[model samples]
Target: MRAIWKGAVSFGLVNVPVRLFSATENHDVQFRQVHEKDGGRIRYQRVCSIDGEEVPYSDIAKGYETSDGRMVILTDEDMKSLPSRSSKEISIEKFVPSEQIDPLLFDKSYYLEPEKSSVKPYVLLRDALEKADRMALVTVAIRTRMTLAVLRVREGVIVLQTLLWADEVRQPDFGVLDEDTHATKKELAMASSLVDSLAGDYEPDEFEDDYSEAVEALVESKIEGGEVKAPEAAPEEETEVVDLLAALQRSVDAAKAAKRGGGTKDEAEATPEKKKPAKKATKAKKKAS
Candidate 1:
C-alpha cells in the first residue's frame, strides 16, 4: 500500500522518521447510479443557484450562510491561517495507561514504518511503550485539520490511531436511563447462570458474515443459471414465549446439551413452543363441556 503521510515522531530528544499507511481497507462491492433502461452512468454538474448558469470549478469558493442570510465567502488564505501542528511532526504530549483512553475516541488507525536511518530511535520508542504498557497521547494535523492521535506499540511496529476531540463525544442526557427499572435477585442470578453456560473466549474468526456470503452465493448462482430462482422456503414457527422460570431452566438445559455436541443452546428452549398449541386444544375441550 502507498504511504499516506511522512513525518517524524518527536519525544524528548529523539526523532523517529516514519511513513504512515492506513491499517484498514474496505472490501465492499461498489455500484453506480445509472439509467435503468440503458445502464448509462448518471452525471451531475455544478451550477449557480441564483443566476441559473453553469459554473466552472475555478469560480467555486467556500461560503457559509449567516443567520441574517448573508453569504460569507472564505478563500484559501483564510484556511491557511488556521494552526496546524501535525503537518510534518508528531509531537508526543504525555504517556497514559492504555486502558485510560476510551475506545469511542478512536477514529482511524495507521501503521508507522521507520526510515532506514531512524530505525534505532524508532525501536527504542516502540520498546519503551511496550515495556511501560502505556500509550503516548499526540496531536497530528492531516489535510490541514488538527486531529488527536495516540502512539502505541502494535505487535512489533508502532501504530498511530487517530482519536475524536472531547467535544465530538456527545453527552447522554436522555431520561430513559434515569428511570428506575429493577431486576429481581432470582432473575439476575438465572441470567448470570445462562451467561456462564455460554461463556467462551471471543475469537473473531469463529464468526462469519452469513448474510454477505449468502448474497454473494446468490449472485454467483444467478450468473451460472442465467435466470433468477425462488429462494428455498424456511420452516414457519410460532413465537412461543414461556414463563420466566421455565424459560431460564429450559435455556440452562439447552446450553448443557449444546456443550455436549448437541445443536445450539436454543434447541431445548424451542421445545416449550409445542405447549402453546396444546393450550388452544384445552380451551376447545372446555367450550364443548
Candidate 2:
C-alpha cells in the first residue's frame, strides 16, 4: 500500500524519520442507483436552490450556515487565509498510562514505518513504550489540520491513532436513567450466573459478516443465472429555454401545493425532468420487491 504521509516522530532530541499508512480498510459491498425500467444509472445534478440551474463543480464554494440562518460563503482564497498546520513532525507531548486513554476517543489509526537509517531509534522507542506499558500523547498535523493522537505498540509496529476532542464526546442524559432502580440480591446473582455461563475468550477470526457474505452469494448466483439488466443510454441535454429563477420559484411553489394536497396530476407532472428521478425510484422499489 502507498504511504499516505511521510514525517518524523520527534521526542526530545531524538527524531525518527517514518512513513504513515492507514492500518484498516473497509470491505463492504456497494450498489449503484439506477432506473429500474431501463437499468440506466441515476444521475443527480447540482442545481442552485435560488435559480434552479445546474451548477458546474468549478463554481461551487463552501458555505457555513449560522444558527440565525445566515450563510457565509468561503472561497479558496478565504480558506487559505485561515490558520493551518502542515508540519512534518509528529511531536510527542508526554507519556501517559495506557488505561487513561479512553477507547471511545480513538478515531482513525495509522501504522508508522521507520526509515532504514532510523531503525535503531525507532526500535528503541517501540521497545521502551512496550516495557513501560504507556502510550505517548502526541500532536500531529495531518491534511493541514492539527490533531491530538496517541502512539501505541501493536504487534511489532508503532501505531498512531487520532483522538476526538473532549467537547466532541456528548454526555449521556436520560430522564428514565434519573429514576433510581435496584436489583434484588437473588436477581443480581441470577444475572451474574447468566453472564458467567456465556463468557468466553474473544477471537475475532471466529466471527463473520453473515449479511455481507449472503449478499455476495446472492449477487453471484443471480449473475450466473443471467439475471443482469442491460443499461440504457442516457439522453443528451438540450439548451434550457426557461428562466432559471422563475423555474426555481415555480418548483418550490409546486412542492408546497403538493404538500398541502392542492396539486392536480397535471401540476405534479409540470416539470417532467425533475419528477423523472422520483418516478424511477418508485419503479425500482416495486421491481426489487
Candidate 3:
C-alpha cells in the first residue's frame, strides 16, 4: 500500500506529480539456511580467494578483470562518473499501440496516483492514451538505475509497468520444432477444434498455487503433532497411442461436456446436500422452545 516512489510523469512541457505504488507483492514463505545438526543459523562471509581471509566492508572495492589477469579497482567516485539517464524525471520518449508490445517484455507494474493539483493533467493523459489505444514508452531512474517502462491507463488510473530491454529476451530456438513434423489435414482440423472447445475467457482468480497450498497443509499437520502421512502416489496411467483425429475428438467432447454444466463424477460426489436430518431439526426445535 505504501508508495515506492514519488515523481512526475513528464511529456514535452506537461508534468504530472504522482506517487508510485507496487501492484504486486511476494507471497511465498521465506526460509533461511541453518545447520541441521545443531540448528544454528548459517552465516556468510566475504572472503578473498588469494589470501584466504575475510574482508571487511571498508576494504571491499569494485573491480573488473582484464584479459591479462589484472584487476582494475574502481572507486565510488569512478562509479559516480558513469552517465545516468534516469535520475530526476520520468521521460516519455514515444507512444505506441498497446497491442504492438510483446507481453513478455512486461516485468512489474506500479499504480500511479496523482497529487490533488495534478489530477487534471493526469486524467487528461489517461483519457488521451485510452482514446488512442496506445501506451507511452517511458524511461525512469530508480535507485541509480534506468528502467524502460510503459505508461498506460487502467480502470481510469495511470499505471506504469517496467519492461525488459530487447537484448534481455532470449531468441526462441526453433531447431527442435523443425526436426521432423508432419500432420494430416484432418488431424490439424481436429486439433484446432479441440483448442477452440477448451478456450475460455481469462480469469486469473480461477488459478491458484496448488503446490504451495499442499506444502502449507503438510506444515500445519507437522505442527499439530500429527504424523505427516506420505500421500499414496497414484499409479500413472499408460498413455495410449490413439489416432490423432480420434484423440482430438475425445478432447473436444470432454471440453464441451465441461462447458455444458455436466459435472464430473468427483464433482457430483463432493457436492454437499441441502437436506437436514429430522433428528437434528427436532433437537433445534426443542432448544428453541
lDDT against the true structure, per candidate, is: 0.85, 0.92, 0.83
Clashing pairs in 1: none
Q: What's the C-alpha lDDT at position 172 in model 3?
A: 91
- Measured by C-alpha RMSD in angstroms, how accurate is candidate 1? 29.7
Model 1, 1-289: lDDT tens digits are 9999998999888888999999999767555776665555566768899999977666889998999999999999997786765478888999999999999999999999999999999999999999999999997877767787999987899999999889999998989879898889999999999999999999989998787788789889987987543344544432334356676886787788778866665644456578588889999999999
| Off by more than 4 A, model 1 | 67-70, 225-289
State model 2's lDDT. Answer: 0.92
Give the alpha carbon lDDT tens digit for every residue of 156-265 in model 3: 88889999999999999878797788899999999999999999999989999987898888889786986434344545433344456676886676667656668773
Give the Cα-based TM-score of candidate 2 against the true structure: 0.80
Residue range 187-228, candidate 2, lDDT tens digits? 999999999999999999999999899999999999999989
Native-structure RMSD, model 2: 16.0
- Could you give me the TM-score of model 3 versus the true structure? 0.71
RMSD, every candidate, angstroms: 29.7, 16.0, 29.4
| Highest-scoring model, lDDT | 2
Residue 72 of model 2 has an lDDT of 99
What overall lDDT, based on C-alpha atoms, would model 3 receive against the true structure?
A: 0.83
